[model samples]
Target: MMRCGSVIKVKPGMLDEYVKLHSSVWPDVLKMIKECNIKNYSIYYKDGYLFSYFEYVGIDYEGDMKRMADDPTTQKWWDVTKPCHIPLETRKKGEWWAEMEEVFHLD
Candidate 1:
């Protein structure tokens, strides 16, 4: 499995709504995440940033990500949560969250 991590800034005054929305994520979105071979997904908040980590078991990582992006449920979920995010200026094109480089790992 390949581990992935990303970070994004949460819009001021929107953390509570963001957290509340994630507290009970939509079932369809969760199912789509698993269908795309993403596991152990978690999102954490710190300061003004949100960090996410997940393991991808699929061989075709890009394809799986595209699949996830194409899902209607996932799109709907994004619609609700995207407003709460303030994507970093440094993030690459088409990235809502800036992908992080893993410098160390044990296990």
Candidate 2:
């Protein structure tokens, strides 16, 4: 499995709402994530920033990501949550969340 992490800022005044929304994530969106071979998906927030971590078990990264991205449930989910995010300006072009480099891992 490959581990990935990403960070995005919660728009001011939207942080609490974002957290609440995540507390009851959509079932279809969760199903899509699992169907795409993603596991251990988790999101955390602190100091107005949100961080996400997940494991990719799919061998075909490109295809799996494309499939997930194209899922209608996911698209609809993003439509609601996207406005609550503030992508770091320094993120690479076309990236919403700035991916974090893994410096260490155990197990």
Candidate 3:
């Protein structure tokens, strides 16, 4: 299994809306995530930033990710989430939420 983290800036004053939207994420979207071998998924918010962490337990990480993105339900889910996030200006090539580096870990 592999763990990944991503960070994004939440639009200035839309934190409430973002939280509300997530509190009731679509059923199909959740189903697709599990189907793609994503587990222990969670999102955290602080100040104006949002952090997401998840584990990839599949044989092919890229393939499972592609499968998730190709799903209609997941696509629709992104449509709603995209507007709520403000991508960093320094985002790297082909990156959506800039990948975060793990500075400290103990386990």
Best by lDDT: 1
TM-score of 3: 0.93
The candidate that achieves the highest TM-score relative to the unseen native structure: 1
Candidate 2 residue-wise lDDT, 1-107, digit = tens: 99999999999999878878888999999999999999999998899889999999989988998998899889999999999999999898867889899999999
Candidate 3 on 1-107: residue-level lDDT in tens? 88889999999878989999999999999999998999999999988999999988989988988898889888889999888899988889877798888788776
Kindly give the stretch of ten consecutive residues in candidate 1 with the minimal lDDT sum.
Answer: 67-76
After superposition, the stretches of candidate 3 with alpha carbons farther than 4 Å from their true spots are none
Clashing pairs in 3: none
* Candidate 1 lDDT score at position 29: 91
Give the Cα-based TM-score of candidate 1 against the true structure.
0.98
Query: What is candidate 3's CA lDDT for residue 44?
Result: 96
TM-scores, all models, native as reference: 0.98, 0.95, 0.93
lDDT of 2 at 52: 95
Return the lDDT, model 2, position 107: 95
- Give residue 92's error in model 3 in angstroms: 2.1
lDDT of candidate 1 vs native? 0.96
Candidate 3, residue 69: the lDDT equals 82
